[model samples]
Target chain A: MSTVVVLAPIIVANWPVITAVVGAAVGSLGFAVVRGEETSQQRGETTTREEIEIDNSEILTSDTGFEEEIVVQREGVRAIFSRDARGVLRVCMEGRGTSHAELRRWGQELIDRVTQQYAYHRIVTELKARNMTIVDEQVEEDHTVKIRVRSW
Target chain B: MAKEELEIEISPSGKVTARTLGVKGPRCLELADLLARIVGREESRTLTHEYYETERQVTDQVDLYGHR
Candidate 1:
């Protein structure tokens, strides 16, 4: 390594990526998205279908001034997405039915995925703005990204 | 050929690590600095054997060109 550096990621929340990750996380845990109309219609229906649901509108709110919270539910895990006063997006996993360690793992995984996507886009955009040619880029299996660029 | 190259790795946790290739001498740090600014704030930096080796090559080239 000619030079090695460590840095704290500057969080510029990419709302699209966050929304996608929320869908992914919920899907991976065997939850289905419930649209507002469907949720209301199914209130009295006896259904055997598994329905771990989240409101799509709440996840895609355009308002960025105040805090927004979206809750995604699984069988026993509740994933909460909220923005703090400082504009920091947070993912919290909580439920009394599951192990605390398991919830923490899920929460951390969501955070890592969001941060990785945000950094990837930010770095690529900045590199282009600086007129550097991106030689190659790849996302590793560990969810890390490697980019090689050439600059005169 | 553009003899300056930068490789950056961003960890899942949002930490960034960058290295310079094909750049010699103090120029290595200069390239790194540019990349660091683009990526994020630098937490720590370590210069490798390649860095020192490139520095020596730059010095040799300067001496050769200067004398001629």
Candidate 2:
């Protein structure tokens, strides 16, 4: 062993990349995407919904031509991820009969998953770019991903 | 020369912990720094005993052999 370092992931990416990671995160958490066209209908049906923003996360988008939002639902709870005016990614949760605390927890979980996926993607891409080889990779029971890489 | 190895673990909450295996001296920090830049800011770092041992070995080798 030589050195050990701990890092806190910072997500700074374009729209498409962020969207793809968001999709993967949602899927991994058992959330199904609520299509753009059907989100309005879904929103209308949830009468007692609540919205909460996830803390300490922002996805920067270069394009300003259009606003894009990704909505996903799991067990009748909906999570909406969109970039605010400041280019800060915002996640809002909506669900009927769900307490505010529950919504917040779900929103945080989604953000956590997104951050993990983003970090994984960045690490793998960088390693490949540097001509490094991943010798082993695995996901632990706690959902933590371990990767071993070698370079001559 | 032995191959340099890096062991990286990304927790469920996305915090990353990386360790350099078989990499000696200051070169280990270089590898860790590269990863820090790729992932994000470094929260904390620990240099194991192995880190200093290599530097001491190099100094001893220099003392015995003189400048090449």
Query: Candidate 2: which stretches are off by over 4 Å?
Result: A40-43, A46-56, A64-67, B61-68
User: For candidate 2, lDDT tens digit of each residue in A14-84?
Assistant: 77787788888778789987775555345467534556554555666566564478888888777888878
Which DockQ value does candidate 1 get? Answer: 0.54
Task: Write candidate 1's Cα lDDT for B5-48 as tens digits.
Answer: 88888887767778788766677787767656655567888888
Model 1 ranges off by over 4 Å: A13-78, A94-96, B52-68
lDDT string for model 2 (B1-68, tens) is: 68999999999999999999989899988998999999988999999987998899989999988856
Q: Model 2 Cα displacement at A128 (Å)? A: 1.0
CA shift at B53, candidate 2, in angstroms? 2.7
**Model 1 steric clash total:** 0
Q: Pick the candidate with the highest TM-score.
A: 2
Candidate topping lDDT: 2
Query: Cα lDDT of model 1 overall?
Result: 0.63
Residue B1, candidate 2: alpha-carbon lDDT: 68
Error of 1 at B35 (Å): 3.2
